[model samples]
Target: MELDEFDLALIEQLRVDGRASFESLGTRVGLSRTAARARVQRFFDSGVLRVAAMVHPEFEGIHAFGHVSITVHGRASAQVAASVAQLPDTPFVSVVSGRHSVVAELRSPDVAHLSDTVSLIRSLDGVQSVDTLILTHLLKEPHIPAHGPGRPEQFDETDRRLLNLLHEDGRMPYADLADGVGLSRGATRTRVLRLLGTGVVSVTGMVNPTALGMTQMSGFQLHLETDGTTALSVIGRLEQVSFLARTLGRCDAIGTLITRARTETVDLLDRMRAIDGVRDVQSWTHLELVKEQYDRRPLRANGAAHGAAASR
Candidate 1:
């Protein structure tokens, strides 16, 4: 579906606040509430946009986040990627070019669970080797800031229920959310606003690159010879980059970039290589994106309750 200027404006607003009311969205986009609602529904039906709530894993008691690079045997990269995507705790999976056949992001409750998940991947047919880099720091994430150590916020049953509903539909009407959580509309609004203010929950639109005319996607592993800080500063401002992080393993920094064509991707990489601090760069074009979920896991109360109750 082709997006007009109004559609782009609406999408930008949703990216900032997915929970915006149709009336509010209409005001921002110079359309009537009914018109705005219809357009948004069309975008959803056409698979152009997805509105969802993403909870911070650290706050949800998930301590281990890993990026796994898998080298498969022979020419079964697609098959290996499919198997990896189906593996438990694997959220993001892609068949990439270069040394690794597949790259996946795994989230686990703890180190033991991460180890178990890695072992399961190794046991998959046609898998040659697996290298994992523990994600120690997140420099940036979609609609959220970098994660840091902070006290886990406490939430009661009512709060959990509210979060669960939001997770299902970030743009769910406040009236519907109130009814679902058994609270007055005003109270529900206050609670949701408070949760957002505290960074316990985030609601935003997750746009698919291909749907937005970005047909080429690639991952880069960069090693810097000059000041790491200066290089990160330069790369972070690049509009083509979607994901960037300071890694602790073999690569100094890792990132994902999206472009409209192979030629454009190559040009973008050349610009990256020309940066003063970049020493070595390994680029991998994504042949197929197997699976990607921003809201991969749910948030739950800590301790004994744990899996018994999930907020997303």
Candidate 2:
């Protein structure tokens, strides 16, 4: 859909504060509280937005995906895609239009669980290969910033406070947020820059594909020569990368998420392969997601980057 400027503005506000109130949202976007509320409802109903409980994987430190890749046979790709996508342990799935067939990311309780899950997927129909990318040290993982879309860039602490309040309860009052964070309406209002600034968090604009008349896009994993300096640099140059993080497992990066364009992801991967010290590129198109909570939480609470928008 060709989103209108107001729609984009409306989406932008929600992107900053998913739970942004109609009143406060109106204030930011120059609309009536009633009008703002209606727009938000429209976004949700249209699959353009969905607000739910998001748990930081790092907080519990349970079991995050450790770079597990599954490949299915020829036409079995569909069956393979469905089988793994439906796996109980699976969280993220993409049936890509690529070499690997189906690429999925699953989280388990422990390494043993991961082993068992992969074994199970391997045993599934049309299964030809499975690759495990164990997460040893998380440089980055599934994260959300202030305002981007579903995934946004890190906003300032001022903005983070707003997020923290919402994280606890998306329905919190802006007046309460302002008072709790020690700022007036206008001052706090000015800090929304964090939504567009730097930090660990990011936001993303989400729309239901079924409603939007499209299917999911594919993502490829690139193992680069270095961290923040190298591998990260490769990821930075990829235009198709909707999200990137320095993670702690098999593939130092993640975001095999549903993309708007498959060709973009592939083109980015190809560019990465040309970089020096770059090894091979493995692309996986997740088919189905028996369980996916990407629109969920940030990292650990205590471990949350100090002064983060979500901090206490």
Candidate 3:
């Protein structure tokens, strides 16, 4: 469905704060509370927007995560890509045109499981070689909340359950959230606020880029001549980059670029190349995003979360 200005505005507001009240949404977009609620429901029913919770792995004691680039033999790229996307560990998988045929993001609660998953990928038919980029720091992630200066507050079992419910439906009403976790509405609201305030989790709306008319998306790897701190600051200012991270592997950092057209991608690449400290930049055009979702491991029991994810 084609989105108009009001639809876009509502989407943008939800992206900033998915739990914003209908009154606030309507006020911002010049609609009545009833109208705003109806519009949001329409977007959800149409699959144009998904509001979900993203929990910080570090806060939950699940730390292993990185990117894997796979080179495949001639006709096998499609088969291999499909196979990788089915794995529980891979949150993001895409077929791209570049030196590597497929790229995926892997997340596991521990290193051993991660290593085993890598071995499994290497054993796949048509897989020639696999390259791993261990993420050292996540500078920016679209739906995931950034854990700013302070430490995360301690949470209990009830909090975990609340997070899981939020992951299932970010815009779930306070009364419903309270019922699920067996807490009073007022108390539940306070806990939810604390979690959001501490950056342990974020409940936000994620728009389908294609639905928003962003037709071109690519993954980029950068090798910088100087230390990454300054370069990171500069790169972070660009709105097109949805995800950015410092890594240890073939490149100093990796990020994703989403643009409206191919021309915009070219322009963005040229601008990135012009940054003072960038030595070289490699990018792969995303032919298809087979899978893309924030990790849901935190919602699962640790024992059950094993068996997939790893680096080369």
How high is each candidate's TM-score? Answer: 0.90, 0.63, 0.90
lDDT of 1 at 73: 91
How would you order the candidates by lDDT, starting with the best?
3, 1, 2
lDDT (tens digit, per residue) of candidate 1 on 1-312: 788999999989888888788999999989999999999899889888888887666665667778889999964898999888876588789998888889998778898999899999999999999998877666656734234324554556677778778877888889999999899999999988877777777888777677889998999888998547787778888888988877767888888888999899889888889988998888988888888754624444452114322221
lDDT by residue for model 3 (186-224), tens? 999999998899887887888877777888999999999
Under the 3 Å rule for N, CA and C atoms, how many clashes does model 2 have?
46
Q: Residue 41 of model 3: what lDDT?
A: 91
Off by over 4 Å in 1: 143-150, 296-299, 303-312
lDDT of 2 at 290: 36
Error of 1 at 259 (Å): 0.8
Q: Alpha-carbon error at 252 in model 1, in Å?
A: 0.7
Q: List RMSD in Å for every model shown.
A: 2.9, 8.4, 3.4
Model 2 residue 119 lDDT score: 88
> What residue runs in model 2 are displaced by over 4 Å at the alpha carbon?
59-61, 73-75, 137-216, 228-239, 245-254, 257-267, 270-312
